[model samples]
Target chain A: MLISNMEIIPGKQIQKHFGLVQGSSVRAKHVGRDIMASLKNIFGGELKGYTELLQESRDEAMDRMQQQAHAIGANAILNVRFSTSSVAQGAAEIYVYGTAVILE
Target chain B: MIELTIFLVLMTLGYLVGQYAEKKHYQSIIEREKRLSGLTTVASRFPPPGKQHDQCLVLGSVVISVDYFKRFIAMLRNLFGGRITSYEALLDRARRESLLRMKEQAAKMGAEYVFNVKYETASISKGRQNTIGSVEVLAYGTALMRPRDEA
Candidate 1:
C-alpha cells in the first residue's frame, strides 16, 4: 500500500476514505544497551544503539498500521503522523496513525 | 574522598569532550545546511498545484544523551527557577541535526521539496532518578519528487 504524510498526493484523487487506522509498539532497552548508553552519556554524543532501536520500533509500528489499513480494503494511507512516549522507566511506545483511503 | 574525586573527574571529562563534540557537530551542520539550501522544507500540508509528482515519506531521527556537566547544571537550574541553557543548546543541536539528516535523505531521492514536516521529541530515559537522561528527536515529512519520466 502507498503511504504518505501529506493530506493529498499530487496527481492522485481519493476515491474513498476508510477512516483512521493506528498502530503502536512498546519497547524497552536491554540492560547491556543501557549500560553502553550510560557510558556514552559521559561524553554527550549520539546514542547510535538507541537510535537504531527506536527506528526499528517505529518501522514496526508503521508496518502494523499498514497491515490494518490493508485489512480494511484501503490501498493507501495518507496524512500519517508519529508520536513517541515514555511509558515506563526503560520502555518507550512508538505510535503512528493515519487516514486509510483508496486512491485513483 | 575517592567518590568525590571520581565525580569531579567525570564532570571535567564530560565538559571538555562534550564541548568539543558540540562544536564539531555545529560546524558540520552549518556546512551541510548551506549545501542543501536549494531543497526546501515547509510545514504546509498542500503541495504546489498543477504539477504531478511522486510523494513518499522521509524521516531522520537521533538520540542524544546529556553529559555529566550539563546534567549537573540543569539540576542546579531546576532549583534556581531559571532557564536551563545547557539543555537549550543540547536540544537545539538535536533538532538541527535531525533536520539536516532528513534533508540529506530527500536529496538522495532527488526530491525537490519536503512538505508537512513535523518533529517529535521523547525523553527515552524518563522517570528513573539518577539515570543518564537522553532525548530522542524525530523529524519527518513527505518528499515530493518529479516523476521519473519528467526527470
Candidate 2:
C-alpha cells in the first residue's frame, strides 16, 4: 500500500478518506542487552542493542497500523505520524497513527 | 580503600570501552550518512520538487540508555547546574543516527526523496531514580519513489 505523511500524494489521487488509523506497542529491554548497554554507557556513544529494540518496536507498530488500514480497505495511509514514550524503566512505547484512504 | 579501588576500576573500564565504542559508532554513522546522501531528507511538510512516482511511509527509531558512569557524572552536574556535556553528546548522536536510519530505510525502498520528516523523543524513567535511564527517538517521513523511466 502507498503511504505518505503529506495530505496529498504527488502522483496519486485520493478517492476516499477513512478517518484515522493507529497502531502501538510497548517493549522492554532484555537482560542481556541491558547488561551490554550499561557497559557501553560508561564511555558513552551509541547503544546498538537499544537501537535495535526501538527499531523493532517501531516496525511492529507500523505493521499493525498497515494491517488496520488494510482492514478498512484503504489502499494507502496518509499523513502518518509517530510518537514514543518510555513507559517504564528499560521499556518503551511506540505509537503510530495516520489517515487511511483509497487512492487511485 | 577497597571500595575506592573498585570504583576506580569500574570508571576506568567504562572510560576505555565507552570511548572506543563511541569513536567506532561515529565513524560508522559518518560513513553511512555519506552513502545515503543521494536520498534527500527534509523536514518540510511539502514534498520536494520532482517528478513523483510512488510514495510510502518510512520510519527509523532507536532507544539508548546512559551508562552508570555518565549517569553519575550527570547527577553531580545537576548539583552545579551547568551543562551536562556527556548527555548532550549522547542525545545529539541519537537524533542524527535516527535520522540517518530513516534515510537508509527510504533508500532501501527505492525512494529518491524523503519529505515531511518528523521526530519524537521520550524519556523512560525507572522506579524512584530521578535520573533518566534511557531515551527513545523516532524519525519518520514519506519516501517518494520516481518512475524507472525518469532515470
Candidate 3:
C-alpha cells in the first residue's frame, strides 16, 4: 500500500522482503482537450488535464500492484519502479513492480 | 467546395500547431537536462546515519519519442485510439527524474542498495478533437543501494 521511489521509509520498519511482486496494465488516453490546450499554450501555464491523467495512471498501476502484494500478504512494497514501452500509436505499457514484504 | 476547403485548412493549421508544440516540449527538456546532467540523489532507510546511504548510477536520461514530428500528421487524422507517442518522452523524463531524486536521497541518508522499485503514469491533460491525448508518468522506487562492503 505504501510506495516511495526511495527504498527506505523513514519511520516504518521493514519486517520482510517480499521479493519480486508486481502488477501492470495497458493505458490509452482519450483526446478531448486539444482545443483548450492549444489556447492554454498561448496563455502559458501548467496543464491540469494531463496532470490528472498521469496521476490516474499511477493510481491504477499502484492498485494492481497492491492487489498482487495483498495476495502475497505483504504490507509494504520496496524499491518500486516503473518502465514504459510503446505498444502502439496511442497505447502504452504501465508496469508497477517491487519486493513484497511484511513490515512490523 | 468553400466549406470543404475551410475544413482542410483548419486541419492543416491544427496539424502544424500540434507539431510546433511537440518540438517545443522536447527543446525545453533538453535545456533542463543540461542543467541536471551531473546532479543526482542519495537516500537510506536505515537507522544511525553513519555510512548507510546507498548509491545508484544516473544513466543519462532521454525522453525518446516520435510524437514531436508526428503531432502534425496526428492532427490531420482523427480517432487515433490508443496509439499516440507523445507520452513516451514525458514518461521517460518522469522515470529518469524519479531515479535521479532517489539517488540523491539515498546518498543523503547514507544507505546503500535501494531495493524494490515501482513506477506509474496518468493523464495530466486530454488531447482535443483536433489532436490526441497527453499523459504524465510518475516513476518511483525504493532508493536501496548495496553497501560498499557488500559490493
Best by DockQ: 1
- Candidate 2 lDDT, tens digit per residue, A50-76? 777877887899899999999999988
- Kindly report the TM-score of the first chain in candidate 1: 0.97
Model 2: per-residue Cα lDDT over B1-151, one tens digit each: 9999988888777666766666777888899988988788878887755566677778787666666577778889999999998788678777888898889888888887888888888776455377666666778888878777877
List model 3 lDDT by residue over A1-104, tens digit each.
65554556644568888698877777655666445444444322335554444446656877888888899888777666766554655455666677887767
User: B38, model 2: CA deviation in Å?
Assistant: 3.1
Ranking by DockQ: 1, 2, 3
TM-scores for all predictions? 0.96, 0.88, 0.45
Report how far off residue A73 is in candidate 1 (Å): 1.4
Q: Which 10 residues in a row give candidate 3 chain A its minimum summed lDDT?
A: A37-46
Candidate 3: where are CA atoms >4 Å away? A8-13, A31-51, B1-151
Candidates in order have lDDT scores of 0.90, 0.79, 0.52
What is the per-residue lDDT of model 1 for residues A28-98, given as tens digits with 9 covering 90 to 100? 98989989998988889899989989999999999999999999999999999999998988789999999
Q: Native-vs-model 3 lDDT?
A: 0.52
Q: DockQ score for model 2, please?
A: 0.58
Question: How well does each candidate reproduce the native contacts, as fnat?
Answer: 0.88, 0.68, 0.08
Best by TM-score: 1
DockQ per candidate: 0.85, 0.58, 0.11
Locate the minimum summed-lDDT window of 10 residues in model 3 chain B: B57-66
lDDT against true structure, model 1: 0.90
Better of 2 and 3 by DockQ: 2
User: How well is each residue in B1-151 modelled by candidate 1, as lDDT tens digits?
Assistant: 9999999999999999999988898899899999999999999999999888888899999999888899888888777788888888888988998999899999999999999999999888887674437889999999989777876
C-alpha positional error of residue B130 in candidate 1 after TM-score superposition, expressed in Å: 8.5
